[model samples]
Target chain A: MQDVPELVAQAREGRPRAVARLISLVEGASPQLREVMAALAPLAGNAYVIGVTGSPGVGKSTSTSALVSAYRKAGKRVAVLAVDPSSPFSGGALLGDRVRMSEHASDPGVYIRSMATRGHLGGLAWAAPQAIRVLDAAGCDVILVETVGVGQSEVEIASQADTSVVLLAPGMGDGIQAAKAGILEIGDVYVVNKADRDGADATARELNHMLGLGESRGPGDWRPPIIKTVAARGEGIDEVVEALEKHRAWLEEHDALTRRRARRAAHEVETIAVTTLRERIGDLHGDRRLGALAERIVAGELDPYTAADELVAGLTDGA
Target chain B: MQDVPELVAQAREGRPRAVARLISLVEGASPQLREVMAALAPLAGNAYVIGVTGSPGVGKSTSTSALVSAYRKAGKRVAVLAVDPSSPFSGGALLGDRVRMSEHASDPGVYIRSMATRGHLGGLAWAAPQAIRVLDAAGCDVILVETVGVGQSEVEIASQADTSVVLLAPGMGDGIQAAKAGILEIGDVYVVNKADRDGADATARELNHMLGLGESRGPGDWRPPIIKTVAARGEGIDEVVEALEKHRAWLEEHDALTRRRARRAAHEVETIAVTTLRERIGDLHGDRRLGALAERIVAGELDPYTAADELVAGLTDGA
Candidate 1:
């Protein structure tokens, strides 16, 4: 219930509970969450945020787990916000992203949490950043956002990161399914995970071919190196991390970090606007005047614009 | 540029060139186009728009072609607007949807045209409906709006249709993907395309289970039957037509059709507003003040909200 500023202050003071609470409140969209988020906004610019996204079985979770483990091994603090869309039958979901990095749960060096996409609005409107804020306050030097790989729309996750890593599996059928897909363009680093598998090299070669074909989405000599990773065996985790570091270097030089944050902030505002406007319309359901008008409109007795004006008029007069 | 009233009139008078030109002109942030669309607004409700969407390789084209042919066989004139996403480099695409219905194309009873989903916000937002309007006035009883398959961000097509058919392919590992996807919940009819493939029965049974588990989205008793179809063989097209007719009857009896059209009207208006706003920004691109602001925003020198507000203010202040 505390204001976001005070909560953010506590989080910056190294309070894990405070950071977690901020994240939970934002996810829940608690009434006062916005004011709190605004207060904490200024404290969020320090951490390196990397987003990992790919198809469902492309080893996103495994790659994330390996990278987090590597960062923790370097004695650096890290956090992971693994996003998954929840099931209709069960409201709760198991965030198995930490399946490979289980030791971190017992070790103090790493923190991982799973969040839901919640509903049809597939993009990360605010959940990812709010989680990032918590990670930043938790003193994590690096935070990784791993998308559930539903494709296309989930590209929002990568756009939010300082450096984006797009994951691909070998022999995933010529990678033709992804050839013209704009999702691959969001990558700052491409990882051919399950590299130990047959045709993994083929996937990598195809990715390099793709990188050569397009107008670069980013500046610099950042070719979005394809780091082949046997994530299950930790075979190429170091190389993946190296590619990530190279991206981080580019961000530092251009100072694109702030602009990235600014872009996300704008998107957050737009999404909130759209969702809020629609939500407000629901509150006008009961008035008979609007009801009759809706009925009449449905009965083809009146035009939609005229009907809408009449419906809103009742709300306005009532207000 | 004689204006929307005259253009809509000419389109109604069977001017194909006028209809195409109007749709192109109206589909952007151009003030003139918005003015024209507003003038032509009251004429949109006469079309029975059927939107068909599903994942790639689901045989959507084949199914659409069959339905159009079926309508033709029933002696009802039909118009098909198959939207295809273009290869970013080619700008040209084969709307091969006609391949399945090539049988009827020369009959003078069917009109099938493939429309491109112009990238970065073009056809989907504007041109589509204009094409629909032309078809509506051309004496077509059924206008099929075959949306370009945009996975995840697909609700746009549903919002625009009187009836929406969600086609799913069998053997797709993600039955759960479609179920929780909000797509299952939106469809007025569900078709299991490629039913000859292995595990088709299981996919249908699972879809039935999921459908049974949820509350219906509207006032329709039609359970969106899982019609099996090997569209390539022209199989089950009759069942698809039957399902569509059942939905039409449900809409007519329960008066959901008017409400559906109203909502579609609202969406069309919003699309127009957004498209017009974007075009306005595009037109003023050469203005030095806006250019500097855009450079600063993209370069991470300033937040987009601040930049956007300044641009809006500058435009109004007659700067």
Candidate 2:
């Protein structure tokens, strides 16, 4: 309900409430979303986005919490956007995870928000970048996006980040499972969490082997480092952070960071355009045009492609 | 590349190879797909689509196989589109399941195809209805769409059916899980498979209670029936078929079948239109316009909404 400019100003002044409100606006797809985004536009592009993702039992939350602690220790303003793509329910199901992250609750430099994609118009794909932008504009030096599951959406969300960290535990058949989940291609830094457990070394070795199998890297290319960590005990997390920094440095050196950000922006713009157009098409459902076309298709008098052509023409002509 | 007309003619004449080729074209998004869809248009709208879905261990494939046998016993031509949304690998990963479905392989009245969403451009959403169109045109009186997971996509595919059948086993904590998965809202008929198991009655009772809790049906509304079936032994399969037929009759009597089919066609048209626009946007990536807009957004000179507006304008203007 606050003015967009006032909210953006407060967010930039390091008010966590304002930051949370901005993200809520994004998640709710508020009518003032455009004004808020415009107000925050110049304030963004300052934060480094790191996406942490893996299977359910691989300690993604613990690893993310540990990373948050490490970043806070380094005197950086950090934001964690915990995204649960699998849950249709929003916020309530993630209350326990938020409680686990309570160590940073009182810290002014750390802001945490949990998002669910079930009721969002374009799901996580459309809402996440905006949420990240809100955090970036709120003066967070590092933004961590943690996803709950290992589905296709998780991989996609992770891939949208400037750096993607994939966590695996020992003896989970994770190496091959990661390959099957298509996370192997998106990870810039691989972390073997729960290192104190047995078979950790073997898991790391298998992951290393799998990473090397088909990828032929040219000189100057970044070879993602595998870091082992016992996140529950806060062990080996610094090395994970170090690997992330090294990857970021490599990306910057090769100008891949600019290209990657551009690609991510392009995807965001495309998703917004497509989502907006889809909404317009949905609006046409109340009109008889789309219904008549559907009836014709159902009556076997028109093919869907031809009908789609007519619909597109109508949309463009109206525009 | 066989000619589209010749392939459609052969497919309508009950040639399984032609049907397979047509589905392949849909899956591949072939250059001649428009021609094929136009050719298949007049022959579709005959097959009644039924979607079968559930969790991985719920014996969905077995139930589907039993249904195929029941339909074949009735001397009706049937086609099964087994969609796997979880597997990133295509037909190769589903070959084993195809072997499980081999009972109907030699039957001239049955056609089976396993599709994976990983490599497809528009995923299962865009490709599924087209594949269903192909099967409908191939003279199948009944089409069963069986998905291989309990994720959001499975729920979506099932909801697209004229009659959605939700399968559950006895002892998997399935009653509550089904509610959480949003399947309870979509099923027109519920099947409690593995009825010989110990908790069969309890599962059915729990499901019935859950289904009754929030729903306020009117006097003439179609109340979903829960059937117990030991699909492995073929027991209670006829009841499931009868339930499906009754649901179909109810749909027809209420004129809901025409409305459902029209709604499905509208969805198909919208998906095609969006997919075509996305391809055009992808083509713009090589032209530097999209890249330029992305650069401005990344540089904080533009917000994604404004960038998206420009992109949409370009697309519509070009159109």
Candidate 3:
């Protein structure tokens, strides 16, 4: 198992089995993942992460596939983590997201991993980033994290991405409601996927209206060029890629890239820091006195607030 | 502010103004909240947390109000944390669920506090629990944490409750879908709220199927009871309370309550541990070495994993 570093090296050399095993090891939270990452981290930064997110059934996966195909044709390797919280026991998506995304399974340039729900809330908070780190280390030119269905975390995709594309389909509902999901604020490039569906133009119009409300954000510095695409048929992908490049250029032009990178670094550290804290808390449950004190508080012999304070500082109370 | 301990004592003496002010201090993460909690912790465990959650607009608030009414009539003081994630700028809900819960406002026995979602992920991650602790310390016999819409952190409700009642509307797409949302496994008592709507039986049946197909794994002395309710007419409030009591008793018979309490104490302490670690990490963010290391990592001359390790250990190889 110490050869995990060698395996990571082989995985980076594009060995299919090695790559699969490496991802499995990382996804399983193998302590060895740290060793692999330690060896592989210097090889990363070649990949740019693009987060595609929207409501369920919004064609995010299809749009992602189309984008993957486009990127592959442009001679770039891509990796995708279609994140979902499905039934862990059945290993089945109660939603058809994972099945639909398996379309690119046969592609040589594309690596798609469907992550299951892990032990905690907040979308397997560490898995997606760790997976992206692996892909980045493995020499993918681009990595795409397609998030779980729309909500608070959905809007977070923008913060995670160097280029974030909020995927939308016209037929689901009103675009204003979608905008109110507040996903519109995060979009560097707007993608109206499933453009052939009816009411696409109206959604686009409404989206523009919502975006119009942000004039105080300083004069449309980033117009969030909306690209219409029928992702199932692979249309409008070039323009999407072109728009991404334009955004990337804009990021560099305005020094936003430096700021964005700094923000990403801060976020990455915060996630790791918070997760470490959670793990430490898990370890402290073994203290018998603390446990008994807690029971007493719950039973009303002592108070919870005072108990919590004492419990925290008890180890060094005399110090 | 430093007189928070005095305020807490006043709250324990049943002063409503003191209770509100104490909870405000707690929910807003004021430094005084710690002092208040230090005085109030022993007072907390008397209140049983009853968590009610389901899809948005599935009449959760209505169900909660009815339950509060039932509990109040039973001579129990009730507090409801109607958790609503607010718009960051205005601190208002996307929709005012409190308006729907207006019927309970005039009742002195029932204290309803509508919490605005703060910087903390719509109050679920941090603020709501702080508010709940205040309510619990203030001697509310039962605390109902009505969810602020389901998502990543919202699922934390399962851990927060002594008895979780997962509320569902009839034909809420499919009962199996709720199971995927981790709802089936969370509830000790599942309420098919709005059973007056057709397909309530179908939903119950599906949930039962899910439970039997390997979700429920308690001592197995008592099944996770499913109660049917049409909360609007207060038709099933008594039954829901009955089910809650039954589950509570079952836990005693099987001694699962001890295990459950242990879990809650561990979770609470774990959150504190994590918060402390993050504070420690935050203290290092402005260090000169960190700035240099971050620059190197961003410039592609250093890897983040090594950078993180060095940052944590305060190691520097730079001359």
Q: Give the winner by lDDT.
A: 2
- Model 3 has a DockQ score of 0.27
Per-residue CA lDDT of candidate 1, range B33-148, in tens? 54554445445456678988776677777788788778878888777777656311111112233346557645655556666555645456566665565566555678887764
Q: What TM-score quantifies how close candidate 3 is to the native fold?
A: 0.77
Better of 1 and 2 by DockQ: 2
Shift of residue B44 alpha carbon in model 2, Å: 2.2
**lDDT per residue as tens, model 2, A1-319:** 7688888889899887778788888777899889898988888998999999888789887888899999999999998888875432235212335445767767788877777765755788888899999999889999999985466766798999999999999999989888888888988999999989999999999999999934788888788889999998999999999998998999899999999999999989988988888777877878799899999999999999999989888888766
| Residue pairs that clash (backbone atoms under 3 angstroms), model 1 | A4-A36, B29-B275, B29-B276, B29-B279
DockQ, model 2, C-alpha based: 0.64
Greater TM-score among 1 and 3 belongs to 3
lDDT of 2 by residue, B162-255 (tens): 9999999998999888888888898999999999999999999999899883478897899999999999899999999999999999999999
**For residues A1-319, could you state the per-residue lDDT of candidate 3 as single tens digits?**
6588777777687665676677767667677867766666677667888888777777777788788878888889887767765411122112223455555556667776667667642345665666777778788888887774455654564457888888788966747656667777788888788888898997887777777844556553777878888888889988999999899888889988766766666556555545543444455568676688667755656544455555445422321
RMSD of 1: 6.6
Candidate 3 lDDT score at position B39? 72
**Total colliding residue pairs, candidate 2:** 0
Worst 10 residues of 2 chain B by lDDT: B87-96
Interface RMSD of each: 7.3, 1.6, 5.6
lDDT comparison, 1 vs 3, better candidate? 3
